[model samples]
Target: MGIMKDFKSFAMRGNVVDLAVAVVIGGAFGKIIASFVNDVLMPPIGLLLGGADFSNLKVVLKAGSEAILNGDAVVTPAVAEVAIKYGSFVNTVVDFTIVAFAIFMVIKAIEKTKKKEAAKPAAPPAPSKEEVLLSEIRDILKEKQ
Candidate 1:
């Protein structure tokens, strides 16, 4: 029961909830960025690169063998193609760069706003009635002296 209460308290913490929400939103944002990169951005870039498809780009390391049965090509087994897909990696890198830059810009704008707010002079607070009475008393005492 104590452990359960502790778990509940931990789960209900503001930071924990905020982090969970951030994780969910971040996942969605990543998906949107990936779609933008793969669907929207990559198509034009691929065209500019002489119709090169990044996803299909790879370096074949091992070419799988085709089996020949009974001196005739009866059934060929599936060939395991080992390759490094750098084009997809490049796309992912671009996505990461864009996301990072966007986050940086957001943070920068927030910091700039904060600085502007801090730089503005705040109005002085009004003095209390007790402070006004004390000043009057002090002035009377000074006159008597």
Candidate 2:
């Protein structure tokens, strides 16, 4: 069918393939940034702020469903059935900041390259042999005058 052929053509486009690859790479890059924020950056920050664990940070809303410990003791693990995680939010903020900064740097570099290209002067056209000969004749005539 013509529709199927058109669809195939669209799917096989280089731009589409490149976009797909970029999306996959972007996902992986996001994971790397998240890990860098959580594992590398947050630890020092948490230590500086009195050993606060951001991931375990939460607000108790319903005091959590009771957990049975030792088959007899009911323990509520700080219920956050409807809680806001400010620490995880901070971690996500850091991740977003890093990714944003990297993208900004890349865009800045690209803009710099574009500016350099724009600033470059075009090469002058080469002089023809006839023009060179004419210039020599003119110089001789001027000297004689």
Each candidate: what lDDT?
0.91, 0.88
In Å, residue 55's CA in model 1 sits off its true spot by 1.4
lDDT of candidate 2 over 80-118, digit per residue (tens) = 377778888888888999999998999999999999999
Cα-based TM-score, every candidate = 0.82, 0.74
Q: Put down candidate 1 lDDT per residue, 108-132, tens digits, no spaces.
A: 9999999999999999999899999
Which window of 10 residues has the lowest lDDT sum in candidate 2?
71-80
Candidate 1 Cα outliers beyond 4 Å, as residue runs? 65-77, 134-145
Clash pairs of candidate 1? none
Q: How does candidate 1 score on lDDT? A: 0.91
- Backbone clash count for every predicted candidate, in the order shown: 0, 1
Candidate maximizing lDDT: 1
The local distance difference test score of model 2 is: 0.88
- Cα shift from native, residue 19, model 2 (Å): 1.8
